[model samples]
Target: MASYFSRRTIDFLLYEVFDATALTRYPHFEAHDRETFAMSLDSVTHIADTLMYPYYREVDRHAPELRQGRVSVHPKVRDMLRALGEAGLIGANFSFEHGGQQLPELVNACLGYILTAANNSMLYTGLTSGAANLINAFGTPDLQSTYVAKLLAGQWQGTMALTEPQAGSSLSDITSTAEPQPDGTYRIMGQKVFISAGDHDAVDNVVHLLLARIAGAPKGTRGISLFVVPKYRLEPSGELTDNDVTSTGIYHKLGQRGTPAMHLVLGERGDCHGWLVGEPHRGLSYMFQMMNEARIAVGITGAGIASAAYYASLAYAKERPQSRRLNEKNQLDAPQTPIINHPDVRRMLLFQKAVVEGSLSLLLESARLADLAHVAEGEAKENYRLLLELLTPVAKTFPTEQGVRSVSEGLQVLGGYGYTEDFPLEQMYRDIRITPIYEGTTGIQAQDLLGRKVPMGGGKALQLLLAEMTQTAQQARTHEALVPYADKLEAEIERLRTVTGALLPYAQRGDTERFLMDATLYMELFGLVVVAWQWLKQGEVAQQVLSTRPPEGDELAFYESKVHTMKYFFHYEVPKTLALATRLTDPEVLTIASEKQVLM
Candidate 1:
């Protein structure tokens, strides 16, 4: 089988670009070192290669079926979850007190990339880890003891049950009701849709980190409260009984079929019980912790599937010879050349490579900032947190939006063979389609970026991010070979400032709709500049390596490829900012509907 990902590239980003080991200097991560991090990665990679990659096709072919009520998934899913749970890969980023390895998000994010690249259909443990971590962070001691261990061990499946039939993305309109009971446990009555891994026979139980509203609370977001609603209620008699959470329906999706997307019903019989997490009316804030983490996780999923697609396409292009070179086409005696030799094919492959690695670099940088936000002190901690918030939407949006395009391009690389199931490219193409819509839709994330994140804290976060990009450009300027790209990145930084400066006034004028009108376009523009910054960071590191102790063979090729791809991104992708900025600053309004104009 062809390789789906490159560990050499992962190491280059983690050690050389991010300096992940430096995180160990902080007391929280002091218990860990490069050796332990390597062990964790190696163990996860073993599980992925043996259990995940080999079944990538088989699992998708044999999607889960919902019968009567039970969700019957491919049997391999159970083994994959078990192995991951046993290896502690699920909660590897959690604290040691919670039975975790306390690894940095930097390394944890890398493991997520490897697993998803191998087989995203077997995506089960991530939900468990996210749900369990929320419980440990906000749930009471009893709640933690009851749910955290089983979830971390992968003995129970965990899911976020937020979307309702009525509310959709408008959480403020959610109607899921929780009534206080004499027994101290509230009764839950609601239906949740698109609940991934919500109900599966792969584990002993299904735990939902569900959202509901209490009686007589404040309206809108302030009224929301989180609950731990389980498929089976643990009775004092030491046995599991039906908790009335039912798998009302199962969705047949375009791809990632190995994991079931469920529609769940709670309290059909009115016996459903839910325990509150954290405080009443504070559920949304607590859930944001998990939601934000899942956003980055979604980006990793995009990057992973794209990486797999790129490799699949790369393998085919190298081996499949089709036509003679354009110059030699008239020479009938000439042999057909491999498609990789074609300029168009090379362009497509280079675009894929640039997106995959650039997305990885940005995501890894976000992960490092998260680590510092968690462990650093005072102003440094606040700065890291703000910087993380600023980049979070971009980190989530770029890999996914660009990843969708890259995978489609990968399919194009194989001609007609790519459209058929005989190749994995078609499935990868399907699987990555949901990422932009996952965690948050591209529009939702874009609104969050411009409407909220940019103007947040008087634009401190934006200022910090600009500072970071400027530093990267300055470093790139030091190496004569990288000066041109450094200028390109610096130019983008200024363009970003000008564009953001242009847009912020609408918000200041109190025109919320006008301010966020082309927010999605703004997101696209923002993604290009930030990714160019990531590329320059990579270029600076590779330039330093090539200048000093560059090794021979693959290592040398790897570093040179980094610099080359960085140049490709600066040349081809960064120029997109000009078009986006032009549209963003234009005074004419087209999208907003006016009541005076009523024709469809």
Candidate 2:
């Protein structure tokens, strides 16, 4: 069987670096310990290996097609969804009352990492889980009772239908109209585009957590309302009927072709029904509840695909012998050495390792904070919430933007074969390219990080983050080998602070255009520093293991590799922040809108 993921590295992050078992001390997660976590992981691994991974190529080879106003997907999608639902993994993080196993988000994040690494094209359940959770949180009792159970059971597919033909990212300009009826439901009429899992034959029905503007409502985002629109509506008599949701077209994409991205038309015949979620004119707020979850999910998907690529490249390097070592070029009769022995190949592998592992560590750390934000109270809860809000964009942006580059590097390790269909790198490279564009593009995420998150609450979140990074650096000081890397992280934090100080003045002066002119570069700088902190944290744990309970053979190599990769990140990746900071703090304005000149 193909090893798409690394269990040892997962264990190192969960048990050693992040100390996930410690989360069980909280009342909400008290039922979970290491054993239950392992049980959930093992269950997903088995299903992923047996059902999903084997069909990775088959699913992509046959993309979904739209015919006769219906969409058809691969046959394996149904079987995969059923297996996941039966495993109780669709709602892994929900409470017992909501028909979930009450698993920690940390563990759930790991579950997603495993599944996506196996076969990302079969991504169906995570969307359902996110949509269902929104219903459970803000919908009426009738809405929850009507939708959550079947959705979790994989009997139905759930999607977030927010993007429309007129409004892509600008939710303020959406023209979708929702007229009220005496029956308390609204008549929805609009066209939505690029809706994933939007319409497919893999499930009995599909539900959309849609957003629309009610008649005579306020303008912009505040006027929007959330609605539950279904492909097949249920009547009071328990019969199903078509809801006037038509599949106008299906998008043929570059990758992740297994799930259908549909162009949907509502009220084509003027007979669409949508039940309101939460209060009217609060749709964007309600949808953000799911959008945030989707963002983190996107980050995990990026890391997962990059991880699979890394493993593929590592295995190929170990087995494929090509050239002799630099020092052995004179030995004409000697056999060629494995590619892994070549210095250039090893450098590429280390870069891949540094990106894949570092991205996962940062994602899991964000997940841990999410779990804390869920259960803690008062000041602790508020602090965790702030920290999560601060890291969400970074967690979303770095893994994806860097994952794309990392997967490309992985492809380079395979030489000519990597570009062909014989290996998975070609497909993986295409698959990971969409992650930075998913949820929100890197530019959008960057604006959020610098314009909103950094300055919010008088900058308490950034202060909290810097203090935490400082604590990690102090802990690493106990080990002599980690001190240099720890010191580098400390310097990076100061650089981040300096850059923020320089940019905040424009924001403070209400120059919105200038304030966000270079926000994307600031985001890149911030991501490097934040990931450096994660590496330092991992290095500290690895150093402790070596000092206290050192082992031989593969075990020693594992811990040593952790420390080595930490140095690799500091030496190779962290220095890029210098150029980014210089650009951010520079007294230059090149991209701002201007009326003085026009050039073709």
Q: Count the backbone clashes (under 3 Å) in each candidate.
A: 0, 0
Q: Stretches of candidate 1 above 4 Å error?
A: 596-599
lDDT of 1 by residue, 10-49 (tens): 9999999999999999999999999999999899999999
lDDT of 2 by residue, 1-600 (tens): 877789999999999888899999999999999999999999999999988999988889989988898889999899889988998999999999999999989899999999999999988999999999999999999999999999999989999999988779998989999999999999999999999999999899999999999999999999999999999999999998999999989888999998899999999999999999999999999999899999999999999999999999999999998868899999988999899999888889998899889999999999999999998999999999999999999999998999999899899999999999999999999999999999999999999999999999999999999999999999999999888888899999999999999989998899999999988999899999999999999989988999999989999999999999989899999999999988888897878868864555
Which window of ten consecutive residues has the lowest lDDT sum in model 1?
591-600
The TM-scores, one per candidate, come to: 0.99, 0.99
What 10-residue stretch in candidate 2 is worst by lDDT?
Answer: 591-600
- As a whole number from 0 to 100, the lDDT of residue 277 in candidate 2 is 95
**Each candidate: RMSD to true structure?**
0.9, 0.9
